[model samples]
Target chain A: MSTTLGRISHGAGLILVLCFTLFPFYWMVSSSFKDQADILASPPVWFFTPTLANYADIFADEKVFGAIVNSLIVATLTTALSVLLGAPAAYALARFEFRGKSDLWFWFISNRMISPIVLALPVYLLAVQLRMLDTYLVLVLIYLTFNLPIVVWICTDQFRSIPSEIEQAARLDGADQFTIFRKIYVPLGLPGIAVSAIFSFIFSWNELLYALVLTRRSVQTAPVMATSFMSGYELPWGKIMATGTLIVLPVTIFALLVSRHMVRGLTMGATK
Target chain B: MRKGGEFVERTETRLNPGYGRWTPFWFLAPAVFALLAIGIYPMLSALVTSFRRYNITRPREGFPFIGFENYANVLSDQTFWQSLGLTARFFVTVLPFQLLFGICIALLLHRPGLGMLRSLARVSLVVPLATTYAVVGLIGRLIFNRDFGVANQFLNAIGIGGMDWLGSPTGAFIAIAVMDIWQWTPFCALIFLAGLSMVPVEIEEAARLETSSKVALLRHVQLPYLLPGLTAMLILRSADILKLFDMVFVMTRGGPGAATDLVSIYIQRVGFRVFDMGTASAQAILLLIMTIILSRLYIRLIYKEIE
Candidate 1:
């Protein structure tokens, strides 16, 4: 009887917590489908006739497609650059010895904590001087600073987890440093690279500050475009939700697909 | 053949003397260069700008070096103090609730016999994490709209009078805080889940054997183990929150009489809107100092824990 009661209480608690946690996400998706009138109706429209009109409006009128392309380009480039640069740096930090190595590692990691707001002003002036405002290159370069540190930090752990013997054996077999990295370390660290790529992509895609400050019109990413929906005198709830849902979908799906890996990546030096 | 092989080995050894020390530097070069250009250089410029009497309006005309004037003005500025106070209030109010709710949800999900539910719970919680702040602000605006918002609708249905969510100072603060909690609790939960997984099964089982009380088990066993992860999460989240701008920018634009204004919003307004580059740089410097101090404290705490 005691065991039964314990199980019942645990089950009840789990259900309640799960419901509370999930209801907001459900509402976001549900409300996105509702028309403007239905959305404002009393008693909160939990059930309603769904429509793609909001999505259509976002695509056709809001120029959200352009923003999507901009986000993809920036995120993809940032991820590629972070992985290419950060992976080997992580390998070197993990496997090799050098002077000022710990200092270098800490300095690299501390870059993550530097608030972007402090950098925004000078970057703006610099961007203006360089005539690089509202350009993809500018956004990618700014994001690389943020993404590369995270990649190095995460990939360092991943690289450390791999045994040194494997790389040594490859080296003994006449494999050059580049070949060993390509054949041994890269293959072994593929998952870590994937996690880093996903993280960098998400960080760049979701980034708002640089995108807002640098881009004016032509190169605005989705987050900036989404902010514009709320800018003018009147708020456009329908289009905002529609664009938001679509913008969130790609990262949400990727996050869900590799959540386990993400967790490992996140907690990478935590346990040790 | 042996001699030739030995020669080849010697050449290889000379060429690569054990995991080439320059490899990491070569790999780290581009990232370091980018960080210098985009990160360190800009920061140094801000530090320099903060010391000068630079105004954005007078871009062509150079300003004289006014050592400490910007900082002095910032120190005397009442709005900066208010913004800092409001930011402290916001952090203090929200961090605890987020941590509690996060741990609770993580614990709930850690139980057995919830196979499919577990997966669903994870994904659903991550949706909010993946959602952009701009979207969160927009959604929050809709839900918290004064007249026709669903929040007011629910209040009216429950016989509570409608409150102006973003119209008043207190309301605006609450609304922003609520939005933050909704978005960030999942992040805390994710970290807690990662930490919880590291808890030893034997300790938990032993606690369960001794006392079937959930609270007791958590208090004596789990909480101690969770301390380091919690501290790390707190530091990361606090740092991120101190720099928060996007959601508040979208929600109220630091409006309803600057009551809900944070340090970041104030800096943006002063710098970009008013074009008081000198004042703004000073304010940015102050914020940077505060963040560095707080993060140093956090690092010390984490290091103590590790020791």
Candidate 2:
């Protein structure tokens, strides 16, 4: 009887946990398909004829589409650049005996923890002064502050897990440091690099403050554009929900694809 | 002596002349350069600006070097202190629940059976973890809508009156905190789950032999074992909460008369809304100091406990 009671409680707990975590997502997506009236319906319209008008409207809007493209471009570039720059640095940190190596690693990791607000004005001013405002290049470069640290930290941990004996053997052969890094570390560290890439991509994609402040019209990303829907006196619930869904879709997919590594991704090199 | 000498000689001759002292530097160069440009340089510029009268509006004045004036002005500002307090309140209020819920859920899922349901619960819980903060804020607004929100509907069903979740100051704060907890508790759970996986089965079984009860086992054994994960979760969540901008911005925009005005929101206002660059920079520096101090304190505390 006690065992049966335990099983029932466990099942109930699992369902409750799932609903609490996933209901917001369900609400967002479900409400997106509802008309403004249906969306506002009290006791919440659990059953309704779903419509694609919200998606249709968003797709038709030039500004929204432009923001989507901008977000895609920025997220892609940031991920690519962060990996290119961070992997070698990570390898060096993992394998080499260098002065201030721990300090360097700490510095890198600490950079990830900084509030974006601290960097916002300075970066904004610098971007404005350089005529780089509303440019993809500037945003991509600035995103390196957060992304590079994560990449280096994760990849360092990744490379550390791979026994250094392989690299040493390659060194003993005629392979140079660069060759060994490219041939051995890159392949071995591919999974970590993928995790870093997904994280950088999602971060760049989800970023709002920088996207809002740094760009005005030409370079607005999806999150900033999503906020624009909220600025009017009357909230565009349908449109905002649609935009929110669109913004969340890619990140959700990327996160799930790398869900196995999320514990490592989030905790950095601290845990497994 | 011979073995030591031979080892030293072998190490000295291990790498060809090509891969020398500068090899690591060369490897680290790009990331270093990126960090220097993107992180260090901007930080220094912000630090320098904090000490000067660098108003973005009054560029013609050439940012006269007014030592300690900006800092003094920001320190005297009541809103600065209020925002700081609110930020702390948000962090303190929401973090414990997240940690608790996280540990609870992790413990639940860590149970021996209910295999498929356990995996399903694990994956579904991460949905919120994957959702963007701004998006979460938007979702919160919808669900907490006074007239037609799902929350009010649920309250009505339970024979309670509906409250204005985003209108009243206390209500708004609670709403945002609940939203934050909802989104982040799963993150805590994931980390704690990872930590639980690292806990030795032998240690657990030995501890269980004495207690023979789940609650006692958790309190005596599992909780102690989860300290590292707790620390990491605390440090990670605290830093983000202290700097929370996007969520609060989207949800309330520090609304109901700045009741939810965190320092990040205040600093943004001072910089962008008020066009007071110097004061904003000073505020940012102060915030940076607080974060570094808090994080260092937590790290020291966690490590001291471990030792």
Candidate 2, residues B40-104: lDDT per residue as tens digits? Answer: 89989999989889888888989888999998998899989999899889989999899889888
Which has the greatest DockQ?
2
lDDT of 2 at B77: 94
For model 1, the superposed segments whose C-alpha errors exceed 4 Å read A1-5, A261-268, B1-21, B298-307
How far residue B75's Cα lies from its native spot in candidate 2, in Å, is 1.2
| lDDT per residue as tens, model 1, B1-307 | 9999999888656545665656767766776777777778888888888998888799787867899999999999999999988888899989998999999888877877657766677767767777777777877888788876777877888899989999998999999998899888877787787677777998888888999788998888888878887877777777777788988998899989997798888888898888888889998888888777765665566544431
Q: What is the C-alpha lDDT of each candidate?
A: 0.80, 0.87
Interface RMSD measured for model 1: 2.8
Give the lDDT of residue A149 in candidate 1: 82
Q: What does DockQ come to for candidate 2?
A: 0.67
Q: Which stretches of candidate 2 lie over 4 Å from their true place?
A: B1-18, B295-307
Clashing pairs in 1: none
lDDT of candidate 1 over A162-254, digit per residue (tens):
887787777778887778778988899988888888888887888888899999999999999888877667556666787888888898888
Chain B vs. true chain B: TM-score for each candidate?
0.90, 0.91
